[model samples]
Target: MYLYPLLIVIAASSYGIVSTIIKLAMQSGFSVSQAVTSQFFFGFCIAICIFIFTNRTKLSFNGVKTLIFAGVFTGLTNIFYGLSLNYLPASLAVVLLFQFTWIGMLISCITKRKFPSRIELISLIILVAGTIPAAGLIHVDLSQLPFQGWLWGLAAALCYSLFLFVNGRATTNMNTSNRLVMVSFFALMMAVFFQSPEVIWNGTLFSEGLWIYGLALGLFGLIIPVYLFTIAVPKVGLSMSSILGATELPIAVMVSVILLNENITSLQMGGIVIIILGMSLPTILNRNMLSITKKSTTLGTK
Candidate 1:
């Protein structure tokens, strides 16, 4: 039980650190395409290595196509997000990316043909309200923010939500490592398509220690989290997984503040707290419902 929760934390923490690392890599002269492509490439390599090392017996091809399709979203999510950072501040970009939380809930509700629960509705309200400040848009001048940046951020959120929805339904019982290899392979292919050939062949990505940054990004941003979440999500369930996943936002903000010298005001901090509260609400409600069910059963038995 604790192990599942711990895996969620590790996955979320790895994801949280990725944006800041990408920012750092950019500051060190890595282009957005270079950063995105290299990360996926390395992620594919690492996943392949792990798949071979652990599951050398035989490979299962079940649900390979669905996993590959999910990989397309995975690739797009990284591309949109990494490019969004080019025109947006890292802090605000991460907050925008966090919109996936509510978006994911909406996707679930629609797919299941059910309205959101009272707790979910309340959570969405709080999430939207908190996003204004958490994104530092409350007092900041709007004219300064690029329209393209916002578009890219929202696109990233949409694709990410779709990815989660698809991933939840795809290849549930397949070998985790093999599934990751296929997913990573397709993700890498998509990254290559979006990436300029000159950047790959011209040795541009090989300079300025970009490979090292790419290795780190691949490990944290793609490889580790996907592996852990693949294992944890089935056990803990999506609502709990999402609540735990909210750990990414604060961890991202903290990393930006500490490593990138980004600043957040008291008001923004308040908003961040609210966002965290919204994310946790669903999981808390789920737990209470379960407890009540158990209690009712016990009482009936008496």
Candidate 2:
């Protein structure tokens, strides 16, 4: 029970670190195209390798198509998120993206045509409350930013939620590598549509040595999260997976402060604590009962 949720946390942590990686790549004179598209390009290449080795179960044409379509949710999430940053401050954009935590819960409700449990509801509120400060948007002047930025930001949020929802159900029992390969290929196609493939065709990958960042981003950003979520979300439920996914923001803030030497206010630190608490809320009570049951079993065996 605990193992699956922890996998989602690990996946979310992988996501949190990508921002720091992107910043480091950009500072090293990499273009946005190189910094961003390398993730998909190398990710697709690596997934192909994995699929070659682990090609046991073959997917039907419909299943392959399903994953390809599902892949668009993540691709659009990144595209919209990038667009939002053009017109809004990074802080504002992140806060808006954080809306996915609740939006995911809303999606869970709509799909199941039911309400979330009491604990899940409370946890959702706490997570949303934490997000405003955790993203450092406590004092945003949204009145000045262009309206299109907000639209894009919210669109990113929705797409991210949908990404989790769709991927959770898309051919879960099929070949893991098959699903991974299909998703990565389409996502790479989407990236190429919006950005240039000059990183490959122009020989920038070797000449500028962008492979280092691309390799890291490929593993951390694309492969790890998608693989883990595909395995865990179906078992843990989308609402809980989304809650665990909120850990990304707090970890991103920590990485920014510790690795990037970015300063965080005391309020932001407090919000980080709140976000962690909220993330743990749904699991903590059940885990305590699990502990007691284990102890009782131990006594019975003795």
Candidate 3:
């Protein structure tokens, strides 16, 4: 049980590091399409290798239909996300996407007919309040930021949230590794269609050490973290996993500060604290309320 939480933390941290590296890769002249497609391609290869080494018979195509559907959303999410990176700062884009938490909750309410408890409502409020600081919206000059970038970022967030929900539903009976491998296969197919074959064959794709960089990007950013996430999700449960995954936001900020020398204003630091506070609300409040209700029931019995 504890192992799942720890794995989630590791996955989140890995994602944070990858976010910064991807930004650097973009700065190194990789196009958004090239970078994203290459990552998926190599990620597919790595998944294949892992599937082969771990156990050949465990891989199954039974879930291919669901995996392909989920992969379409996943591919689109990453493509738009990469495009947003071209226009927005890594930290800003990440904060915007983290809005998925609320989106997911709302979706749950609609689909599950399960309204959030008072504690969950409080958590939602804290999450929104925390974003003001996390996004540096208080200090940043919006006039300079492109509207297109913001649109792409929001689109990416919505798509990513959908991907998460779909993937969660699809992997119900599938092994984590098997599901991941199928997801990668479908993602690779989607990427191939979107990427230019001529450029790939002409070796333009591999120029500027993309061969090496692409492999590393796939392994660290796509393969390992995703595998870890799949394994962690069932163990910790979706709500806890999502909350713990929010760690990626701060990790991204710190990675940008350290690796990219991105500036972190005092307000931005405060925002981080606010986000953390917001994330804790659901866990803390819900647990306490549950305890209180249990105690009240015992007293009523007397």
Give the candidate number with the greatest TM-score: 1
Error of 1 at 94 (Å): 1.7
lDDT of each: 0.79, 0.82, 0.72
Superior candidate under TM-score, 1 versus 2: 1
Deviation from native of the Cα of residue 138 in model 2, angstroms:
2.8
lDDT of 3: 0.72
TM-score of 2: 0.89
RMSD of 2: 3.2
Q: Estimate each model's TM-score.
A: 0.90, 0.89, 0.86
* Root-mean-square deviation (CA) per prediction: 2.3, 3.2, 3.0
Cα lDDT tens digits for candidate 1, 184-282:
888889987887435656776676577887888899988988888777876765545655676678778777889888887888799889878876777
Global local distance difference test of model 2: 0.82
Could you give me the TM-score of model 1 versus the true structure? 0.90
Off by over 4 Å in 2: 56-62, 140-142, 170-173, 288-302
Q: Considering only N, C-alpha and C atoms within 3 Å, which residue pairs clash in candidate 2?
A: none
> Which rank order by TM-score, best down to worst?
1, 2, 3
Q: What residue runs in model 1 are displaced by over 4 Å at the alpha carbon?
A: 1-6, 197-201, 234-244
